[model samples]
Target: MLNTNNVDCCARVRHGPSVAGLQQALGNGAMSNSISDIENSKCLLVLATTAPTPIPSSPAG
Candidate 1:
C-alpha cells in the first residue's frame, strides 16, 4: 500500500547513543559536577579543532 499525496512519505531516523552524547555535551552545568566547577573557576582556557566547509550553491543551468 502507498499514499502518493503524503509529502512525508520518507522515514526519518535518530540514533539513540548519538542523541544522548549530544545531550550530554550541550547539557546545562547542573548535569555534571565538573561542568559546575569549570563554571565557577576564575580562569578558563578553551582549545578546539574545527574543520570548516565552503559555502554551497546550485550550479548555473
Candidate 2:
C-alpha cells in the first residue's frame, strides 16, 4: 500500500546528453588540434548552439 498525500512529487526533470555521451562525441569537448591548424585550413565549418555575438574592439592606445 502507498500513501499519495504523504508523497511530495515536487521535482524538476531535465533531458540532455549524459557526460559519457559528450566525452564520446567530442573527446572532453576540447580542441584536439592547435590554432595553427585552423589557419592552414582552406575552408572552415563553424557549429554552435547559439548565434554568435560580436565584441567591440578596444581603442588602440
- For this target, which candidate reaches the highest lDDT against the unseen true structure? 2
Off by over 4 Å in 1: 4-14, 28-61
lDDT of 1 by residue, 1-61 (tens): 2866544311123234655665788763223447779879999675552327332233224
Give a tens-digit lDDT track for model 2, residues 12-50: 121124445667887773456789999999998877633
lDDT of every model, 2 decimals: 0.49, 0.53
Per TM-score, the best of the predicted structures is 2
Kindly state the number of residue pairs that clash in model 1: 0
Clashing pairs in 1: none
Score residue 15 of candidate 1 by CA lDDT: 37
Question: Each model's RMSD to truth, in Å?
Answer: 11.5, 17.8
Candidate 1 TM-score, C-alpha based: 0.25
